[model samples]
Target: MRLTMLTFGLFAGPAFAQPGPPAEGPDEIVVTGQKRDGTLQDADASITVLDAEAIDQARLRDFRQLDDLVPNVQFNEAGQLSNVFITIRGVESNPFIVNRAAVYIDGIPFRELTNAVLSQVESIEVLRGPQGTLYGANSESGLIVIRTRAPSRDAEGEVRVTGSLFSGTGGAGIEAYYSTPLVSDTLAASLAVKYGREATWMRNRAAGVTEPGEIEERFVHGRLRWTPSDRTTLNATAYLLDINAPGLFDNDFFPQDRTLYDQLYGALNGGRPSGRYGYFHDAPKRTDETEYVLGLSVAHEVGSGTVDAAVSYRRDRSDSLGLDFDFTSLPTAAGRDDNDQRVTNAELRYASAQQQPLSFLAGVAYFRDDKDNQKSTFVGPGDLDSYVAAPVQTRSIESLSGFGSLRWRPAFVRDVTLSAGLRYDHTRQRAVQREGQLDLGGGSILYYTDARLASTDDAWLPRFSITWEPTDDATFFGTIARGYIPGGFNLAATQENITDPDVLRYRSETMWSYEIGFRVRSADGRFRASGAVFQIDSNNWQEIRVLTDETGRPVSSDFIGSSASIRSRGFEVEASWRAVPGFDLSASFGYADATYLYLFNGIEDLAGNRVKLVPEYDANLSARYQHRSGVFARAAMNFVGAMALDERSYAVQPATTMIDLQLGYENERFTARLFVDNLTNVRRFSGLGFDNLAFGTDGTVYGALEAPRIVGAEVEMRF
Candidate 1:
């Protein structure tokens, strides 16, 4: 047993508790990550804040449990619950297009991350880099803002329960929430609910089906608030989600020497006989999903300046069933996929006032999306030994934007400050495609068509900043930015290789960023520090591949037609210390290189490599303790470094460390907790798929594992 990596450390392990002040002195942390709302050391970018008691003391239920505790966030989403892939600082994009990092709730904008939900979240702000002058076109790898939970002026309620111990892959959960005040101080309301289920340890050696990967979920929420005077306010929200999982090539495969439970019963009937071998399957994979959301917000304070508005509507539906494509148990092949989506949004803003040397902010935005997608495959099942493969698509998108920002304060230096921002965006798109193959009684061997392909794109984003505050706990900052991503239409397969529908439309991705930072607070704030250095450069950059047909079967895949260049550089450090009085300590460290400059795809050149799941170093350490007869304890550790999931494979995903422990008892209305997550049982491997990486006898190596070892217990009540 041996494994140790720990790239950068600040006294080793733990994080998520560093906003400072308390233990009877100092205090700060009231942030919005700059859409105006201040105080995270007066915000100058490079932020990360997770409140709500640090998300219930790290029970962080989403976003991959907030990996590395927010130090250059990274992901690959093993056994995906809905196609997840995100990277920040290493800015990733194209996991079948769209999403270059952007998520917001309470300010709309969502298109993935399974529709972003974290129960009744009350705070979460992560704005790492390239926020494109106040968000535009996916913000080019940066931004995740959430704020929920508001509505309580008198009554309140809560309830919770959780259990897991992994005895035959265990899991369980339950939740509830409530709030009130309906016209007391001028209205308020809230409600929430949740449920969960899990169990799956992978066992299905040719239909034996022991645990076969399982998951289930459900959630619901609602809110409303109004305050007709004292400068007006209004808000409303709604949500719903349901999910079921197990797919992403249903796990259990490991070659390079048996020992995945003895190669799953020796590949269930041992090797070749028309491709029916290993991890032993018989075609069955699943997924089903549903989502919906609605929102509205308004604010006013006209005299001293402030006005805001927002609106949203969304819907999503998905289904993917049994896709053993060719993991071999000889059903020959199988597939089914579907998607439907809709969205609408709007925003408006204005801000000014703050005495003295000029200040301003202005904004406008609108967006719309509609989509439908389908994919199907089946081979040999009826009438003349049937085979059918279908592909369908329909899409539309529209967007418009306007933005502004300006600020300056000068009376001969005296604590300098300057800022600038600009944004202009326009987009329009429409695409419809159909590619087919069928033979149910011998008919229509193949066909392809793409009609109504239209496109339009425009952009101009910019930002600049400088700040220096020589006192009140010090600060220094600098920044420069520009970012964008837009371009689409690609869905063609069947030995596809540029069958020119105008080259299948793909282009648009750009970035440029630079930063410098510093922050400090220790004049009785019990010590706090921050640091940053950054650089980013990108161009074009998009990816997708899979094509075959010539005695190796499997035909069709697309997306790639010139343009690739990338670069990333990073440095970050964060700290907190309270020492004594109720005890607390925190730490963070990060580093990134994220290579690739002039990457190739016309037969692999891969310029300088690196940059597939993005990781070059990340660290976190945490410690906390409290007593006064309430009792508490916590310990944490995190690390990730080593990633490459393909771009001309070498299959990597090592460098891991995760340790967590928690114990509790609280008062102000009872609570209890006990947790242990991946404490040590690390079997490693968290996603990799090459869609049969050029099938050379090793085809079908599909893998996903890691999430074994959980022991949880929770209980709560409040009123």
Candidate 2:
């Protein structure tokens, strides 16, 4: 069967694309749920597809390790990559950078949902729950559709590159991608780029330092499409990102010093970086991103069905420059600038035309976000950072939305089928603030912010699904959802006593999800399995209160909302088997028994905090082999199972597994790839921390996760 679908598409490319030939059959699949065109066992809910040959054989530069290989998904990123936690089934994450997952690149919807990134990806449709109607707002706990690689309608495009090596003072980098087509059927375009430099396997103590803090990333994208007939279409896209990293493996912001992190992990029990710890330094950060997109699509018919339309526009800009202290003896540093955003969105829809078994959808959307900022904090040089400059903040956002959906196949449940949707959003917010004091020849004065303390909010989201197929490869599903996240104004300052309590009185978090899934394909195609069970019900639960002082630094706090109650139940299993044709075996297992049933008022020290960087159980196993002239070989293993580091609750960070190897070769255009990650050069620590040694408060930090086991390769050419 086409070499078993190209050895199951070589588990999605990290080097050379595989999984070729499938214009039909393999049980037809391509879905965004009720957005239309179903098949993934008739789409009902719960979806996970990586593809792109598993992002070039898992060289994955921030695929967030595919979050435990998918299931109750959770991927947290801090420091340089900033806050990127795309949680699912956990009901939504609320740490910082207000992004509770809601990203899209294909149907356009990414005005900064934490700028989800995964270079040149061609497929990555996560979709867990509460995707209002067709997906709107932060989506509460689901939706991550990032589909790139467009601009080839009648012919070619290809390019590839890879590099990596990390064990101690991290360093190694590279990645690239390309595509083309100009008038073969209208217009086309594509692009991808990446760069890296690594160092900082941590051990910085007084000039006994070594090369510390290093990492850099760059991204670019372009797209254009147009078709006049055979149904209509138009598309325009743009993207850019630039970042300078000096710390990317955040060990959850150190300084809760546990004997200085057990004397720096017993002075390197898992050692490397032999330069006797010399040259360690801190305080560095720089990030910038720019994006703009334009889109249009149309389909016409009418008589029986087929009448679809879509429209969109977007503009975004994000900026950051660092060292305010992840520590290097906190010399208080800052050179920040944010010219936030200006966005626009438009969507018009109509579905149900063609050969109808009944289909429908509608839409109207508009959005605007604006911001400007400039800040400063310095010491020792440049005239005290130019006398402490200022212009702190400015913000604005305007939104209006409407959405709809429907699908039917009612005829006495001929194997049943039904889908539903709804979405409504109305938001208006404004904030302008500035405050930085210290004068009388000490220079530094800025205070401005108060325009009747602006704010506004409104949202209504709902989505439903049900799909049952007695046969067709087997399928069963059910879903109920409600999600949304957006609430602002809090530059820190929490009041507990004497007058002062208007940090824009923020609060708004809602979630309700219930899911069930099972999709099987066996009959004779070897094997493919999917199973899921989920439960999410949350209220308020946006908690963060760290106002330390007395050497704990940070004395600004105001990020509250907690009638606190969170519950997430999960179970997921994934499978793939061919075992004979060219050899293949894929497996995944997940189990998340989350907690925090409720907590309010009495704080009770957060009564049992077992929900941070969750890891109840996780596993992934792979075996691959393919040859016919397009050589291939694979062996993989990744497992993580213990974590939970903070929230007034004790500590834990254990459970490690890493064994990866991949080799590839392709033809018909040109392709090559190689891989190896922690292939046993093991020296683990992927986050989960604390060490508050009794008031003498030791303070130590280490964040350089799995790099010492290095390897890299990538090459591509197509046209």
Candidate 3:
């Protein structure tokens, strides 16, 4: 398909322009996914590129808006800002396994789930296969690279305001960006600021609150660029983010037993019955978070090549209180969580010039992460005096890696290229969990086990690819790659009945992926198409599983462990056509068949089951019409197929289709737009959590509700 292009000449001139037909063939798209700049058509990998214009057209404020935009990929949010997860090509990500894929934002690596704010972003590249040969650990499935706008030499600024109204909720936001030169051709500075507040669709019935899930967020980003000479450049950046959300947790639980749930909560006086988006909780639920980041980078031209270096430091702190575990007003169980994390990263790399017939890239990287977490559960009142169980844990991890890649074009082979890359990583992790005694009230005390664990692991990842371009308009390629995810100790204490050491400290998981792809475009550049087919096999697949005692009774919290082997295969295709002047059409489709080859839970072998949270198929279609008079209208539809919610296939989310519409007018100085998202108001669960063991209910499921219909308008002005 024709990748969307949005160019804002922020430093030079006007920032807004009307869409029109290109004078010649489609625009050439450049990407830095390989640690070097190259055209997307020449890259031998599956990638999706979205520029700033596409991001604005879709109103993609956060990562969750990328649900159906890419093939073989899905984005889900588990009811909170820090609980987002992405599933790629049947490989699922959860709260425990948050780093199935790696994310890099402006040279900063985020192993854990972050807010992922998309304001002032220049471009985003989604690489669909394993990127371990370059990214190292935590990239077993895929990688996402985000590049924000850099400081420009010219002075420019913009201000934008937005408002939205959804079912039973509303929100408003504002953003501003400014860039100016400090010295002529020597130094420049840029700054961006954003603030927003929105009320979630969820309501609390027992508490008599209309909009309990209100959230407020603020962000500030600053950058300085200094060019000491024509051959060297230095850039430094600082970022801050703060969020406050009331009555929102990582996941909200609700009893699936309709008969029992209604019997317990339906007859309450002046209270509505609990449902998917409405709950019966009387306790105060709130979450507060803050993050600070600083980064610096340097690039220097060395004869026929360039050397690049970067370093970053980040600190995150969060506190949450009042989790109604029972999903009722009776206060049977409640919980709280507090977390802190600090991360430091550094990397140095060198790349040969791209014009040569042969080129090479080498890099070395180091990373360190420290985390402290505390979780507490209360039985009677939601306070420390009623604590039934509490656990405190601390973990430290360090990783070092070296990677290199080479690309060659043999003189004997016309229009063909070969590439190979490898990376070696060693990681050490140490953790301690202190599960102190629990007070069950009335002087009743229960003691739990405490443990300390440490482990060191190593991985050698490799990738190979070959590409052939017989004609300027057509390119074909094939690739094989290895991906890895490091192992770590579980934070939960070992149960008395569990004897397997693997449960306490899981082993690393690995995957091998094979793929072949082709991209073709019409001579006139009016039509473009791309297709790919791929297969992946995984060993030592890790997942969170509940522990049971000798009598088959539940013990402690769930822990990560190696579950089984998995095989996934999929194919995807995309096409875009400029039907006529000022009109365009684009479509994409994906299909995947993923299943477990061998699954054993220490008791029974359950194989051949479909992987959880993976849809069988997904598709998107869009049509747009733009007039020469600076007016445009667009319509799009997205479809997602049915998929199992859990490993046991107890619940399923049926197939769903959503439609969106947009109309706008734009000019050099002012722009306005009206949009409607999820026009049909399709309400379905995005994720599921089994709470049968925690609540002592027969098959109680805690579901994460999807967003409802939203109607919004936006206005922008440039100076």
Candidate 4:
């Protein structure tokens, strides 16, 4: 039994590490996705785990860094603090619909993926496939769980400083973490803080601005834990984050036709083409954002199980000034946005002892969110006076869910286990949008919309799995799961000459996923590997659509449910090997075939088109070598395949490769490191958007390019 557990741990997840000296063999990895502590194999799911050592080695300061390390997953960053999307297994997430997969930070749910600071962390777990049976709605694609380091009985602290240069831009940052015992044997507290500033890499040629994308950020996190008795425990946590970026949304625009590049450049510039990071926007641009979170949790031991309860509150606010809708120096149009959001979440659960043949977990959860949004379009000269259209809206969402899971191990067949889970969720939403008015100096046009709108949706998600371990070195599993995303009223729903109810409210989206997987480890523990293949069938997939008038001119846009059926099939494999005493190698590869089985929009038929924003394949390879004298070196290469940028497949991003290298020396008290990311200086674009609608040019397209080659150094000291 001991050997069986050791083999399972080695093949369960990607990696794990302890705090002190390195172990001779792989460390055991425990996961909490089932609301209880258990091995990754026990969870009956495909998951990726990264511990503190891996994170530190990778220099993972933000979510975007995960794109190169994780297979079949991509983190799309729009060059702003609040603009981020996570795509998993071809289930893409866009700016408008941001929560394809749910994210949890220390048990606090964040439906919208924000670019939060990742510092002083413990472990990160990425779970692929639908997790609605345990996490509820907004987790149709998958889930990401972040567990922060907790306070310890002994006093400990660390301080770090880093400096970096990327794409002609320079940046510096500082971070500190401290944890100590508050009382002799009952209470402990921890605190973490971070500050960073970066000079803009972009130059606004038209505005004569040298650095248009300057950014600054500050973050703080604190927590307290109390163990009143052997059977009772409590925890309280609070965090605050603030960011300010000027001209962060200033994207570069170019012509679709290669031959027209010179013509477009001559028109924007004075007969000279723009640089790689140069744009022609003249409007004033600014973005400021702030967020705060508070959380509390309690646990108590019962007769044969443990009861847990947790609650959290979060508030987020942002204000943005300009995007240069026309993508030119001419002040044809600019935009302004003000948004505020508040969220509250609570959950209670009980888990039976894991040693029993029959173990179970049950939970009930509640969630509420309120949003106030205002958007305005400024037109005419200087984009300072006169309005094209302005609208203000308020929305409220509430949800209630109950979920349960059971795992049974038969006495007759100790090697086989069966697991099942189910969850029922009900959601309600209410919204009110004021009529928008457009004043272009000639006359005033009114865009009328329903003053009050409401929607209600319910879903029942279920999952089933079977696991068999015939030998101590090998394991096999199969699973089937259901995923769901609730429907909601469109923020821009209008009543003027529109009669179809479907246009105002979209239907829910659902999918069924089937998977089979295997895990294996060598008897000597020098090698471990895992592989899985899956198929997903989806119905009523929601898509963003533009509303056109009688003249075929675009007016407004909204999320609409598509009648088309979609399918995604994929396979992923990962392996790690210790070649020698101080050398290790790892590699991963993934391939996905996602397409529209059948589709008929109002204007065109995209029956066989590939799904937008999903890559065809991705691969990664890395090697690390360490010396007994506390010296180490690592190198990694990542590849991403081509992907369609739009449903019509009119535009696409070509495949690209990136390489990173790191060298460091570490000891008990001090450490220093040097690293280079994107060593080849490859050009990577997150999105390519066509601009032919209102306040746009006919043959122009815009995109946000990722930062170029970055070179940095860091130093850390521990006390």
Residue 130 in candidate 3, Cα distance off native in Å: 0.8
Error of 4 at 325 (Å): 0.8
How big is the RMSD of model 3? 4.6
lDDT of 1 by residue, 525-551 (tens): 877888788999888777665454444
- Model 3 over residues 1-719: C-alpha lDDT tens digits? 00011111121111111122433566766666667757777888988777787776666666666755777887765664546677788887776676687877766777775544466777778888899988898877888877778788999999988888875668888889999999998999998887888776666676544337777878777888888887788888887788888776645655545556676556542445666556777555777888888888888889998888888888888877666655666655566778999999998888888778999999999999999987766666554344344666789999999999999999999999999999999999998867675433223333546777889999999999999999878999999999988887665535343446766778888999999999988888788888899999998888666554453333444477676888999998888899999898888898889888877766666578888788889899988887889898989999999977766666777899999889999888888999888899887667655544334434445567677788888898988
The candidate that achieves the highest lDDT relative to the unseen native structure: 3
Runs with alpha carbons beyond 4 Å of true place in candidate 4: 1-26, 208-211, 250-262, 383-389, 438-448, 548-555, 692-697
Encode model 2's per-residue lDDT on 1-719: one tens digit a residue.
00000000010111111233444446354554345545456678778777677665554555555674676676654433444556565543534445577766566655344423355566777887778666677767778765555556655545554454443434454545555667776665555555555554434442322324554555555555555554445555555555554432232244333354445443332232223222223334444455445555545545554455555555555555443332333333334445555555555556553136667767677766676766554542222124355555677778788888777778877888787778888888777665443221113222334333467788888777788889878888888888866666665431222225443355666778888888888766578788888888777666555444465434332345445667778878888888788778888877777666765423364645666667777778878787878898888887877766445435555777888887988777877777776688655444334332112234443332333465666666665
lDDT per residue (tens digit) for residues 385-454 in model 4: 4334466689888999999999999999979989999999999989897776643221224365647889
- For each candidate, what TM-score against the reference? 0.34, 0.33, 0.92, 0.92
Query: Per lDDT, what order, best first?
Result: 3, 4, 1, 2
Evaluate residue 424 in candidate 4 and report its C-alpha lDDT on the 0 to 100 scale.
97
Question: In model 3, what are the clashing residue pairs, if there are any?
Answer: none
RMSD from true fold, candidate 1: 22.7
